[model samples]
Target: MGSLGSRVLRRKAGLPRGEAAAAGKGGKRKRGGAEGTGDSDSDGEAEREERLLHLRGRRKKLKSTSKYIYQTLFLNGENSDIKICALGEEWNLHKIYLCQSGYFSSMFSGSWKESSMNVIELEIPDQNIDVEALQVAFGSLYRDDVLINPSRVVALLAAACMLQLDGLIQQCGETMKETITAQTVCAYYNSAGTYGLDSVKKKCLEWLLNNLMTHQSVGLFKELSINLMKQLISSSNLFVLQVEMDVYTALKKWMFLQLVPSWNGSFKQVLTEADAWFAERRREFGGDISFLESAQGSAFLPVFAHLRLQYIISDLASARIVERDALLPSEWLSSVYKQQWFAMLRAEQDNDTGPQEINKEELEGNSMRCGRKLAKDGDYCWRWTGFNFGLDLLVTYTNRYIIFKRNTLNQPCSGSVSLQPRRSIAFRLRLASFDCSGKMICSRTTGYQILTLEKDQEQIVMNLDSRLLTFPLYICCNFLYTSPEKRADSEAQLDHLES
Candidate 1:
């Protein structure tokens, strides 16, 4: 039977019977289970390849469909469901894409009258919101990348906020943060405040506080609104090495800039020129300075109310106030003097105790007894006095040591001052006097002690033999509290010094 089957198979293959029989025997030997398994594995691999190709084709088709829809609706505006008019320009946009925002969704999807309208008019009142910003905001709805710069960011943010586009608002904030600098921070901060961007507002304010002197040097303070100025000056967190007088000086400069329309260039030059003009006019007018006084008084009324007058420790700064007749009215200055006298009496009564807290109402009432403007306990306090005569003092009490720092800037006189911590939580001071041009003439470190807390009250008497003093003499002081452990350390250091 095997022979017969071989003959039939050979005939079917159309080969010589002997050759076909030999081939069949060889094939049968090779196909012993393993050959069958090899054929089955190849078939499975082919099937998987075919399935993968099918999936790839489907994905391509889906991607092509999405691309076509975006191109037609957003780019070409070919089946746009709505038109938007902004700043005298028209934009054809799709309702579906616009509906992604709650603002637009509510406008177009509900039974409101706008839903039936084909064109929507955006009537945002901000003059800063222009056509370019609107284009960027509208493009952002369909695309991921939008160009933003300092000049356009304010407008873009305003538009985005009006549209209620959270994504775009966040993007604007991030861009502002990246681009913020001393020169541009004021504008950005104002824009953020206008649009209610709290995060951006906080960041800009912190930067301003940290780099206040830098900003002042660049005349950025001239751009600040009264409210913004008040906010900054009144913040307890503002850290500056400058005396409160420097702050007052900066404020005066800002006010001067606002008053004088043609003023330009260096503040010193403008001030010098103005002083000459004032001097010439004073002579011509027989020293009647009432007009100049009235102008300054009106301009400074809003600003002066925010000044922490008690913090001005420099006699030079205070004298400047009287000489120039600047912010502090005579009545106000008199009240301040009276307050100082009372404080001195109180300190004597308390036997020179630690920091004393005065009642705000009582102080205000006493200072301005009749129709007096009330003062709030803001950043202005006796604890921190502005630097005077190129000298500033800082006293910090921690668990460790009572630290004292005396800083001198641009001092014409040259001398070293030694500070020794005493057992009474005070520092015994020694000061040397130098003549103008940095020449040391006299030294006096003995017979003087300053309580770290009330050091602002103690006057440094210069008994220098030099016939001339270049800078007006003033001393400023500040006291800071620290942790309990630091306080203990401070006490121990005091005891060691006494021992």
Candidate 2:
């Protein structure tokens, strides 16, 4: 068989028998099988090895070429296709790589005016987009390895957003998540909101909800803008240990900081600064006082507009507010009281018989006791004197009944309150019963009611219901106001009444 195979191989090779045998012996031994089968297998294996080696060489060359291209376009800027001017610095960039961004794609492709230019001048109108951020953003397109830290992530995010780079935006968001803490989150949230980075904004807000009451959170609150503050305070997701009063106090601290210029000290310092500024202005204006009052009132109106006064639990927390009169304007305090009163009245009207009607003369005497006071001692006269919607009234409430007396005080009304005259203020009240575990057992809310006093009425009194006397019961008040246009009209009427 071997001889026949050798002869057949010799014939195919067209070689003499002896010469063919010599060549076969030499090649066959190297190939490692009998009858030359090994020669074909070895040749195939050699071809595969050569192909693999060539492929590896080509890959290395391609990688080197890519590196060279990046260097030429970025580091050297030799033959760069575009010029990006950000924050007064010029960056020479390649249009091909930059075109990966929607911003660059739109500018360089299609019928846009910049498409035809070899040297495109790119300018992001925002001053926050700095050159270093641009460098990081541009570098990331060509390389897989990019570094993002807390310090540079904000600027990079801003630049990436402006450039419409979704991938880089996502990367920045991930970096922000890794870096977020109570101290740094607010700054990141502000940046995200400013740049419209919704993903990062959401994460920051969620983080805030969890960490809002921490000692570190005060730093964040100090830096929050009025609009942001309002957004946070009004958000349903915000969780606080003491929902009503702690939030109110934090809001007050924020507002005081906003009102006082260059204020770095405590809330007391803020009040002092405000007082000094007002006094200085009054003296400067020859004690005219009107302009200063108006300016200060306007400043505070926006701040107070965001405060949810009705949510404040009216027991001990509100009592503290009464003691620290400087924390809120008297008129704001009054609005809070009125809201609570209206809520109580609503609860009573819904859960029990409608308000116990009393003759106007019954409450005529100054400081007349209304319903029987609760057994608990101590002054429970919940008094607040702030404008609510279009009504400017001094409100006082006790365990038995609530009193609303139209405030005739000469203090100028701040625009923060609704100016429209409301025919009546509507509100709801809930009496919550809690168990020993501090969980609510049952809650009863009153049907909505509109409390309207007669034109000649000095005070309107509504009696507390007997059903609300259960131990561990909480009276929750919610106030509803008229629409803005209606509020303006009501405010005008109240202004006339005051005059």
lDDT score for residue 158 of model 1: 84
Cα TM-score of candidate 2 = 0.51
TM-score of each: 0.58, 0.51
RMSD of each: 17.6, 16.8
User: Model 1 residue 441 lDDT?
Assistant: 42
lDDT of 2 by residue, 106-146 (tens): 87778988788766566677767788998889877776557
Stretches of candidate 2 exceeding 4 Å from the true structure: 1-73, 78-92, 111-116, 215-219, 265-294, 302-313, 323-499
**Candidate 1 displacement at residue 430 in angstroms:** 26
Model 1 alpha-carbon drift over 4 Å, by segment = 1-72, 217-219, 267-270, 273-296, 311-322, 325-327, 344-350, 356-402, 405-477, 480-499
> Residue 215 error for model 2, in Å?
4.2
What would the per-residue lDDT of candidate 1 be over residues 89-153, giving only the tens digit for each residue? 88899888898777898898788999988998878687888888888787778765666876788
The total of clashing pairs for model 1 equals: 13
Q: What is the lDDT of residue 452 in candidate 1?
A: 41
